[model samples]
Target: MKHNRKLNIFLIIIIIVSIIPLTSCIKDNVQPISKTEYMLGTICTITVYDNKPESVIDKAFARIKEIENKMSVNKPGTELDAVADAAGKNFVKVSKDTFYVLKKGKYYSEQSSGAFDITVGPLVKLWGIGTDNARLPSQSEIDEKKSLINYKDLLLDEKDSKVMLKRQGMSLDLGGIAKGYSADEAARILKENGVKHAIVNLGGNILAINTNTNGKPWNIGVQDPFKTRGDPAGGLNVTNKTVVTSGIYERYFEKNGKKYHHILNPFTGYPMDNNLASVTLVTDVSIDADAMTKNIFYLGVDKGMDYVNKKNGLQAIFITKDKKVYVTDGLKGNFQITNSSFKLMDKK
Candidate 1:
């Protein structure tokens, strides 16, 4: 009986020792927290590496939802709707969120010399791009709507947090910059909650929280303009940065064998015609990258590169119609061209 008891005790000691290593391994491998939702007319995904991921993720998403409710023009009774309703009549008092976004949108409009305009809302509604009603508009209609698309008329009273559209028919569309702003806000929330690693993908406006959990830079693929979605023309390795791509491929329609894309020129009231197919901007803030992309796209490759070069801390990748890729100096080593059919241009 004594020998049998000794053997059982020895076996118990071995079992506990074996279980320790397994438990330690499991504890070290923390699964990433991921969640997705439909918002801002596209899928917004948030993934974070955190000890208490649920709380942080919920807080991050809440901020995005708050922005959408206040800024979305599609949603009736929103602050944007109130401003549009009072256009040419009175100033609409808006929440701080709406005021900040509109203020920044107007700033971009001025910086781009009207190349990017938020007041293009009137024209956007006329074309109805991305909606089932999308169709080619007659020149007369285009001209009429073009008259209402001026960013200068968007008045912002910062002291009182108000917005006023100067003309009766004028409207404000935050679609261009809203998603990027939301992504930035979500990232801010994540960091505030002690999340060290995360990825905020708001409709492909990607903001990497920091380096990947593996301690390597995040690799983001730039979509191929002519191919199906998720097809990569190149990849960028980045850490703690925003990568946003504005391409003709994003929203478009086919009519009479010709393609009409959503990026309209504020000046011409027609789709911006630059030979370039897509422009990707990398910057510290997703909002700036998102707002500046259309301006660069309208500028085309040459002037676009000049604009990107002059801006401190901004890098751009311009993919042309002829399958040539022009990358700003900052991205030379960081951007890898994955598609063999595309040629990386030598420095001009």
Candidate 2:
């Protein structure tokens, strides 16, 4: 009886030790706090994998809404609208957030040599590409709007944080870069709230806050521009980085057997007629990645590759209509093509 009692005590100790780890595993696998909202004209999702309460995610979403309210062109009485309303009149003071985005937009506009301009708002509103009233405008209408599409006319009074449009009809539509900024802001909120790992996705502007719950890099799927959403042509492993794609498939309308995308050319006041279907930029900052997409796409595959290779700490992938995947030298080994239909090109 004494021997049996000793064996029973040993077995109980082993069982309790095993169950301790099991409880910890259960806690680790608790469903991450995920929240989704539609603001800024796109689906925004903030997912946290830690034990943090849902308030953290809500705070992130709130930050995005604040940014949208400040910079949204569709919303009247917004800071962006105030600036546009005062175009060619007087400089309007804007919030620090608005001014910061405008400054970044102008910098990229100049860097891309006006291939991507923040002042393309006039042409964007005329075409109404993503709106219900989208239609093709006459040649004269396009030319008239194109004249107001120069980034040089966007005057920034840095000292006062005031902005003015040199032309009366010029508008500032941040559709190109606002979401990226919002995503970054959301990530900031999550981090400040002690979220160690999270995914902040504002439409296609995907930002990974940190590694996944598994302590590995997050896997971000590259949208197949030719197919519907969720169909990935490839996948990229990213950690604490953002993956932004500027593709013709994102926003477009069909008219009389022809398809017109939203990424308009500031120079010609028309959709960019390049063979490239999409351009994906991988970087640490979502705002930079967001605006750079248009600039790189405008340059096409060859020049775009050259532009990306010249820059440090930046990588880009250009997917051409021919189904050839051209990745920058930095992303050569990092990018993997999942779809057999699309082939990865060899380095030149």
Candidate 3:
């Protein structure tokens, strides 16, 4: 989905804060600096707390660069590009990392009953809603693409670490979950590198490792789907968790006075028109949370909440187009609603 508000401003703020020094020690004569940057089509903010020399920060950046090289679609030989190229062709043997991501995609597809599909790539390419070449495809075009879109059609050979699309013209787009996966991977690398406290923000997918240097939960703001530009719509305080959101207001194109968003429903081959404006999921696993946000958005408010409530260790915040907010029972104590425009709905 296309963000109605200009995201450049928010990106700037994230970039600036990511580079500033996180802490300084007065007694030990130590200076701890945190380095961060925006890469891989998402903002990655890495904050490390350590008295180690600048080499640690350099290694962190080096790891991030490695991830960017491996996972980026822009890079010709990357695994993502390989998947894109192998679309409609033979099975593509991917790296273990890529296989793990596809495995999570398939898992969520089953969990959400096909609401979140990686095989919706054909439809996404057809609509081109988020790109400069955005347009509404004809019914026949949508139908043809829909025939090629199904997660069940994706065949995974675990032993060989290969991915195959059952039919011709089928493709896989990891856009929905790649950011979160990268964040999780980056955080894992930091932890392995002896960085205990860190935050990885890949745009809407925010993941925290351990806690902040202050021993407090990391504060994450949920971008208001309807709020005017430059206003805070309140946020959630989370510790060692992942918060990912999928909203119709993110990216889209307008045609015939109607908005066509980037988030396509695999069932309808079009953007979801449910009452929900956005869906945010909180979980220990950012990959699952990322996939679930898109799934819940497509599932609509009622079924989405039902799905979250049924799943253990999952909490969600739902915002309807009419400005109504609903929080699952699991989130009752975890999140605080600060927007007067939002009203909490009681579970039935």
RMSD to truth, every model: 13.7, 13.5, 3.9
Report how far residue 85 has shifted in candidate 3, in Å.
Answer: 4.3
TM-score, per-candidate, Cα-based? 0.90, 0.90, 0.85
Model 2's alpha-carbon lDDT is 0.81
Clashes of 1: 0
- After superposition, the stretches of candidate 2 with alpha carbons farther than 4 Å from their true spots are 1-28
lDDT of 1 at 197: 78
Between 2 and 3, whose lDDT is larger?
Answer: 2
Q: Report, for every candidate in turn, its global Cα lDDT versus the true structure.
A: 0.82, 0.81, 0.72
* Model 2: colliding residue pairs: none
Candidate 1's TM-score reads: 0.90
Q: Residue 129 lDDT in model 1?
A: 75
- Among all windows of ten consecutive residues in candidate 3, which has the lowest summed lDDT? 18-27
Q: Write the per-residue lDDT of candidate 3 for residues 150-250, one digit (tens) a residue.
A: 89988889999998887777777778887778777777777777876666666677777766566666666676776432233456777788878777656
The sequence of per-residue lDDT tens digits that candidate 2 reaches over residues 246-347 is 898767887777888899999888999999999999999999999999988998888888888887788988899989998877776667888899999885
